[model samples]
Target: MLQMLSSLLHHGSSVPENSPLPYTVKVSSRAKNARLKMTPHGGLVVVLPEGFNKKHLPALLQRHEAWIKQAAARIEVHRPEPLPLTENGLPYTIALHNSNEKWSVVYNNQGRRVLDVDDAGGRRLLLSADVADAELCRSQLLTWLKRQAHKHLIPSLGKLAAAQDFKYAEALVRLQHSRWGSCTSRQLITLNTKLLFLPDHLVRYIMIHELCHTVQMNHSKAFWALVSKHDPLWHTHNVEMKSAWKYVPAWVSAQS
Candidate 1:
């Protein structure tokens, strides 16, 4: 992803003078080159290839300083407000908009650490853990969220693929930090569990986007054309996706 961002930069381009901004440096063995990524939460991240020259970082950052500031400002405009927290700093409810289901969370201190899906049609979650162990509760909640995603997202993707006559190997659900969904060369599709927080239409759009990747791996014009053939409103959904992270509860990423 960082490498993809670097391709947008103009090599040898002049940038205006600006104060150096605080940023984090991450070295990735998979990185073919150094790049800058401005995340909605993390302001600026400089991803460097392993063994890359540290001396070139100053010039590299300077060259991309303008882009970084602009990206940061854009992210700030769409940044989500923090979610409301309970006394134990956990969410009171888990809303899976994609599945059109909302589950109330009832935390119980039973001197045990476990989470149970209530038999009430799975509309309630019974969490048994030390209230003081917020991290444990959060982890349990995250695990539950992944299970929900697995139950819903995978089948939904399969249905969409079948309906559209698209073929794929398999679908999997995971908690991804930087992507909503991804498709591998072997046709395996992995969707982010956080996608459950998004609206149904947007979630469908993401699935379709990944499904399109099975045919066209890159974001070329032909790929988008294919997507348009299936989802005429994909453009609108794509624009809305820029700020869709706001729908995700804060606790989901609290420990991330």
Candidate 2:
């Protein structure tokens, strides 16, 4: 009887299980108590409370099947609208980002990396004309972006690591599709290039949070305490990180 029931649960009860239920509710207990969650993973994940019995999980999932399907279908959101085309839509003869003391964009007609700060024009950046090819523009822009990351982020993480006496393996910037940052067991950290659009404070806070993972792998209280030691205002940064996408112009992803 148990084998038959297990088979039914995994394989769908012959075609009869296709019927839909009106509403489904997932009861997840991650910490000490069961907390309601609006959005679970692609299917559903009921995080059981500590010392919870695993035997009753099947029944719980079966009871909420309708709700799972409904929530999944209703809450799906397509990726945001792509950035509109440029005025002419012609591939840029060149696209550039100036990283001299500040950040700004440039267009066709510039040397590869000749940045001349002209004091004469109230301190404006002047690029040379030789490196003005399309490929060179993007390449230079990437290099400039990495340089920006190194300058703004590396030192901050270094200070955070020092405070905790944790040795970070490495820190790198990536063009990931969805993840913001991650910490490996080796203590190496990877940050999303989208972080460039995030405010510097939030970016630093994320770096600190990931670096702290060197000492603590999970989001347990100890891990958060580690983060708070370096950045007491981290909660504000966390909130800002949540809304960071809205502020990022579409061009950043396009360049990479």
lDDT scores in order: 0.78, 0.52
lDDT of 2 by residue, 1-256 (tens): 0000000011122222343432222333446754322221212334457666756655655666676576555434422333343352212222221122333343435444554434464433344434435345444545555656666566666776787677888987765545678888987887766566555676667777787788898888998888899899988877656445543443343433
lDDT of 1 by residue, 1-256 (tens): 0011211121232222454566767778999999877644444677889999977888898888789788777766765555556886798877677887878888888848889888568689888998788888899989989999999989889899999999999889988766788999999988989889888898889989999999999999999999999899999988887667667766774434
Query: Candidate 1: worst 10 consecutive residues by lDDT?
Result: 1-10
Best by lDDT: 1
TM-score of candidate 1 to 2 decimals: 0.71
Please report how far candidate 2 places residue 182 from its true position, in Å. Answer: 1.8
